[model samples]
Target: MMTFKFARPLAWLLLAFIIFVTVSPIGERPNTVTMVDVDRAVAYLLLGFAFALAYPKQWKMVAMLLIVGAFAIEYLQYFSPTRHPRLHDAGIKAMGAALGLLAGWVINRWRETKAPNGLPFAER
Candidate 1:
């Protein structure tokens, strides 16, 4: 018999949200409740968290993917009429990703210590 894995749905949703926000016009975004740098970091932080949790064993690959993705998205923004690519934004994203990865590591450790379980989420 074969089983299916339906874990990490939140991660999938996070990826979709990231793509949408990245490509959308800057003017269309909601009024900022925080600084731009902080917003960018928070966005990428969640992205990194989702990815790290989804692929716990492949953190290095996740880091590379996140870095490449940050660059790719910024590059795409260069061509958008209302958006500009900035290295500082990318740096913020990298920092956020690092923090998120660290958080994910901590969560994984806690889960392991408490449950000694193979998977973080139960199979559905």
Candidate 2:
């Protein structure tokens, strides 16, 4: 089996992409599905996945960072002239983060199970 290593530069690029999608005004217009909310949620989810992929052993840290990042962004919005953060938006973000973390845990657990000499479900 191939040993997969996380590429530091690629990870940084992904982080930059997440930040751009999170704060950019390119999708500020009102529309069905609410592009801003969707993008924010997706960004959070992707961020969680990225962190998990890069540091599979640091799942708790990933979760903490996601929650803190969401809260910080919401707080920042209060001072932004163009944006006022909504409680509902924060709730949506939190839910997205939770779902993303859960997905990451599931994928990681599955990978561990399939690894050579990994403990079987009954043993674990």
Per-residue accuracy of model 1 over 14-110 as CA lDDT, tens digit each: 7677766776798776666699888889888988887777776677888888877877877778677888888887788888887887787677556
Best by lDDT: 1
RMSD (CA, Å), each prediction: 4.3, 4.7
How displaced is residue 63 in candidate 2, in Å? 0.2
State which candidate has the highest TM-score.
1
TM-score of every candidate:
0.80, 0.70
- Spell out the clash pairs found in candidate 2: none
Q: Please give the CA lDDT of all the candidate structures.
A: 0.72, 0.64
- In model 2, which regions exceed 4 Å deviation? 1-15, 18-36, 118-124
Task: Show where candidate 1 strays beyond 4 Å.
Answer: 1-7, 117-124
The TM-score that candidate 2 achieves is: 0.70
